[model samples]
Target: MATAPPPKSQHVGAAVAEKATSHVAQYSPDEKWAERSRKAMQDAITNPPADAYAGRSVKNTGNLAIAFRSLNEILVRNKVRQTVRMTERHEKKGTKRRRLQSERWRKQFSNEVRKKVQLVIKIRNRGA
Candidate 1:
């Protein structure tokens, strides 16, 4: 006797999985970045700084800069080399020209941020 075909539910489930995987594969670089940013924001909001810094709450304020600063401070206290990158812009006093001076502003990141990013990836991969 011939075996019976798979149930309709199995086919539907396979199709849903294919669609979901295809959607993920089609995410653009910007979309991926936005997704990561959102996750980081959520993590920051969930885990607030322990000490009160100038009575400012990184979570409540919804400021990524402040959250980064807090994370950097924690890394510093723990003697971690990974730090957040920061950049500043300044206008020179002269003719009708504006130029950024290297000495005036710099973009820098420590090894701690990398570690943190890796941790985030691990957490995401584990479906947590």
Candidate 2:
């Protein structure tokens, strides 16, 4: 007697379809929320605060440093050692002013402001 082929063994495609349908049941809203929260936290950590550049003088202090550097380059090109001494004197004056400011005063001044103040001193001295 020939046995009937085991009810044709449900199609392989049907087995895959059943698995896909059951997968929807396995989803947890809590897991999705946790994933989203983690992503948001990471994004926040990577981004700078909104006021990041508000106090930074991209023009003034930055330009002054560049000017000083270029001035040194010009002096080197001219083979003048005297301007280097002058640059050192200006830097020393700026450093002295910075050192003279009490810690309490420095705490009141932002870094950019402090840098601009020093830059001003360097400029006036350089001109003199």
- Cα-based RMSD of the predictions, in order? 19.0, 21.1
Q: For residue 61, what is the lDDT in candidate 2?
A: 59
Model 2: per-residue Cα lDDT over 16-76, one tens digit each: 8877898575549998899899999999898756783333323445678886776666656
Q: What is the lDDT of candidate 1?
A: 0.66
Local distance difference test, each candidate: 0.66, 0.69
* Candidate 2 off by > 4 Å: 1-26, 52-128
Q: Model 1, poorest ten-residue lDDT window?
A: 82-91
In terms of lDDT, the best-performing candidate is 2
Report the number of the highest-TM-score candidate. 2
Itemize residue pairs with steric clashes in candidate 2.
none
Q: How close is candidate 2 to the true structure, as a TM-score?
A: 0.24
Error of 1 at 118 (Å): 55
- Give me the displacement of residue 111 in model 2, in angstroms: 36
State every prediction's TM-score relative to the real structure.
0.23, 0.24
